[model samples]
Target: MHYFSQSFNYDHSWARVVIGMWHKYPNPHCSHVVTVDVVDRTVDPRTGIIRTERILGCKQRAPIWIVKLFGGSEDAFVREISFVDPSTQTTTISSVNLSLSQFATCNEMIRYSPAPGGRTAFHQTAEIETRMNMWRSAADKLENWLALRFEQNAQLGKVGFTDVLRQLWEDAKDKPAHVSA
Candidate 1:
């Protein structure tokens, strides 16, 4: 098993950053995410919290050895669940890869919260583990590869989301205010 964690701050408010999360896909930097579908969603009227479940489709090339060993193509799928609480100004998202569950599992967690100076703090962690009863050498190699890929994708995600937030808020900031007749 391999573990990874990272934390940073975004130059945006918590609310704005959480709202930008939904628009992160289809970004150039994170092009591996091909499709996103909302499977379930609910809002708590009393607490003003929203929970959402989604499936994300991803396509990325795998190493030749991995392809031969795993017998899978470039397509993969992930199940993601998220919770947003306005009262606490926090958002949390968790995801797991579904395509390669029999061989291994990659679980990821991300959180966005209010930070000092009106910024949003971002934190992420992941665990990559190969199923038991596999050859130890092969399992270690697989875990290492997955960890490297996850780190790369995490960096890309940060860059992509930064672009999305800037575009979203900057464009809105530039627009003129509407006047009621």
Candidate 2:
């Protein structure tokens, strides 16, 4: 198993940052994230909290060795679930790779919260583990590759979301008072 974690601040308010999260895709920085579909969603009226489940489709070329060894393709899918609590000014997202799950799994969690100076704090962590009992060497290689890919994607996600937020709020003279998750 391999672990990764990172934290940073976005130059946007918590609400605006959270709202921009929904529009981070189709970005040049993270072109691998090609499609996003909301599979489920719910809103708690009493608490004013929102929960959403989505499936993300990604297309990226894998290493030739990995493709040959694992018989994998360029297409992959991820299942993501997110919760937004307006009352607390917090948003949390968790995702797991749906493809190649029998061999390995990549679990990622991200959080956005209010920070000082009206910025939003972004924190992310991930765990990559191989489930295969045998072929220890192959499993290790797979885990390492997945970890590297995840780190790259994470960086791109940060840049992509930052751009989205800037485009959505920075240029606008009037920002929306409230944005639903």
Candidate 3:
């Protein structure tokens, strides 16, 4: 198993960050994500917390050898579950690939919380497990390559998320505020 962790700060409130995360799939930086569908969404009556499940279809670029091995295609489906606690200003998300489990599974978790300056501090952790039925030496090489690729992808995701946050801020700024009764 390969593990990865990263943290970054967004110059927006936790609420906006959460909103951005929901709308992040269609952005230019994430063109690989072709479709997003909400499988479930509900609010807990007792705790007032919201929970959601979503599925994403992604088309990813693969190495030449992998493309050849997979017959020239690298499409994957991912499922995500998230919990939102507005009272605590926190949201946590966990995601994993739904397909190709035998070859590999990438499990990811992300947490968002309010920061000192009205920003949001985001923390992410991931584990990539190789489950391929291959020779030991080849499996080791594949795992190492996947680890390096995941690191690069994580950085790109941060930049994409930042862009999403900026768009959310602008959208919120243009909205009219509601007055309490």
Candidate 3 total steric clashes: 0
Put down candidate 2 lDDT per residue, 56-99, tens digits, no spaces: 99999999999888887999999999999999998999999999
What clash count goes with each model?
A: 0, 0, 0
User: Against the hidden reference, what TM-scores do the models get?
Assistant: 0.93, 0.94, 0.86
Highest-scoring model, TM-score: 2
Off by over 4 Å in 2: 173-181
Q: What is residue 107's positional error in candidate 3, in angstroms?
A: 1.1
Among all windows of 10 consecutive residues in model 1, the one with the lowest summed lDDT is 172-181
Q: Write the per-residue lDDT of candidate 1 for residues 7-74, one digit (tens) a residue.
A: 99999888778878888889999999999999999998889889999999999999999998888999
Clashing pairs in 3: none
Better of 1 and 3 by TM-score: 1
TM-score, cand. 1 vs. native:
0.93
lDDT of each: 0.90, 0.90, 0.80
Angstrom error at residue 82, model 2 = 0.3
For candidate 3, lDDT tens digit of each residue in 1-181? 8999988888887777877777787878777788999999999999989999999988887788765543436687889999999889889999987865667778999999999987899999999888857777656766776688778878878888888767656656655422122
Better of 1 and 2 by TM-score: 2
Candidate 2 residue pairs in backbone clash: none
Task: State how far residue 165 of model 2 sits from its true place (Å).
Answer: 0.9
| Model 1: colliding residue pairs | none
